[model samples]
Target: MATPAADLANWIPRLLATWRAARRTQRRGGPRPPLDALLPDELREVAAAVTRLSTGLTRERELAGARYLDDERLLGAYLLFYWPISYLQARGVLSELPRLPRTVLDLGSGPGPLAFAALDAGAVAVTACDRAKQALTAARDLARLAGARLTTRDWNPTQGTPLASLTGGTPPDLITLGHVINELWKGEGAEEKRAALLESAARALAPGGSLVVIEPALRDTSRGLLRVRDLLVSRGFAVRAPCLFRGACPALLKESDWCHAERAIDPPPLVAQIGKAAGLRKEAVKMSYLVLAPPGEPWAAPPPGVVLRIVSEPLAGKGRLRYMGCGPDGRKGLALQEKHVGDANRRFETLKRGDVVALEGTEPRGDGLALGAGSRVTVLAEAGRPVPMPVDGQA
Candidate 1:
């Protein structure tokens, strides 16, 4: 029942303590100042390192899958800043799962942010797997400080390692690969290889379990995830959330456009300070994620009536409210003129990127559908909440 934000409230200071302890070269006997009260110079230093780390991971592509986290300064920046973001993103995606996961396996888990996130979100058993030893050690240290049980393993999928090696011979209810799928198997036929890895994970899933994939919101990464999604869907896998178009991904019809989701956040104080100094935006969390059921499982039936998942933020126009929605019918433009906006359909004016909306009295217009004054709009699900399964038109 604990929301990611509510649970993360307990993790912020423990993360700070672990990060501070990691920086110590010698044990000091006396009382030392709290690391939460970072000095101006210290903040500036970490911010500069954060800027560099962000560049290498996002823009430069120099540190995408590298051992950047082994470096103390960059690792500190990650633990203090990016770790919270990953935790929030993982928790948000987990919230959309149809069934709460009892056990989780977090692949390529640097410092085990997603691993800890799974624990905080109610997963009883979790294993953080990665190839980097320092990152795994950091994860262990944080677990020690939080008094939470965590498991860590050395995992390198590039060597063609099967997930069974890390599963302790028992499949987890949920397996998460956060921001690490795109970094694997570079060059030609990479999409096929990624799909293969996902297929293996899907085969290893417990009955009614889910394999959750979270990637960065960058254009290339998101498109890559879409391609992998298409491959799995082609392989007869069923997506549990974030996709109503059960066929090929419509977002990949174009080269420039990609799909992603975003949600507003009240970041921790230290994260805000680090963001201010690093020149990064921490106000809203953004990522491309997918939750897929194993083969033979069917997609959840759409609630009665015309339902569509709002897949875009508000598109700018002079007098019309416009968004792109993907549903069983396919992806199409959804428009509502400002003049036609009334009490019934006013909620459509401020829909988020991931909100699932149900409509009544909609008419086909341009490429999609239009809402008139008589139209009624109901939000079936918020950005992170799970969409309810309707029975006899009742949710």
Candidate 2:
């Protein structure tokens, strides 16, 4: 449903303007800042801070609960580099919503990447809530620069009022937690707290609304999200997208395996430069996410026949092409022998992770469904493409 940075191409200039205005270092009457501000020196500084911030958030785990975003350099680093990543990530997930959200509430909205992304994706009213005052200020700055209307509030679940306080009397059509829940509680029963918060939000959601939770794709975080998903599922809640299985997640059976999706992206020039200088890859964005429906909303029925989401990248062997797919039947391997790749099933030769595909023909081979001469391949949804719901068809 969402292609990539192209959907947000106009965001490039507005973000540059906001960052440039914040720096306030341009000489009087000097040339305006280019869309891709190739300020090598500034890029180096931002990249160095990006390297530190990235490490602290991903590897070192020291800044999990800290106010690192308050640091001028660190915030700048996030604005130029990580903001685009989160923005694109949100768009990818937003593409899967059953309906476009008219009202959105983004919790832990650091400098408002996801909140603003919601606005760009067509949300009419959005409230960006975060405890970091400095971050909220930046959100305002970005909003002003873009000439876009946004609501900013200070709300930290750890300290502030209950989650219900932020919603006022009217429930939001969409509530988003972008890389926020993992930062809360950090100790025993963290997963429970995360699930509890999401459940509350789901219950409070407007009818036909969605509650989206996006987390880091790190193995531990991904598994933690799966555990939370299981908890919510056990309580009789249903998922809107990404889970064809109605039961506890099958990916968690193996300790080493986790679920995450990679969507193609072409980083803006400065983002690529900063990433290169920081020793990171910026070609694509990756995250583990859940799209949960409000209470009483049932899971969209799966398409007819054998259908599964390609969970793993193509696992090609000497004579076969294989992928792990998770569907209503639970997770299973899908294999097609090289000799069996014909006109009908030749589409299997090019398969990407996150693609929802249907398989027909052939008996079971090793660990999955195999394809043979009679087999026909149909791609119900490509990576990042939205799946059809019952509202659209037979689901």
Task: Please give the CA lDDT of all the candidate structures.
Answer: 0.88, 0.85
* Lowest summed lDDT window (length 10), candidate 2: 24-33
How well does model 1 score by local distance difference test? 0.88
Clashing residue pairs for model 2 = 1-385
Give the candidate number with the greatest lDDT.
1
Tens digits of lDDT, candidate 2, 1-395: 34456646666676666666777455466555467664666777788899999999999789887899888778888888888899989988988887889899999999988998899889989999999887888899888878889998889777745777888778999999999888988878888988888998898899999999999999988899999999999998999878999999999999999999998777877788888889999787889999999988778888888888999888989898888989888988888889877898988888888889888775776666777878998999998778764642344
Q: Estimate each model's TM-score.
A: 0.95, 0.94
Indicate the TM-score of model 2: 0.94
TM-score result, candidate 1: 0.95
**Per-residue alpha-carbon lDDT of candidate 1 for residues 357-383, written as tens digits (9 for 90 to 100):** 999999999789988999999999999
Measured over all alpha carbons after superposition, the RMSD of each candidate to the real structure, in angstroms, is: 2.2, 2.2
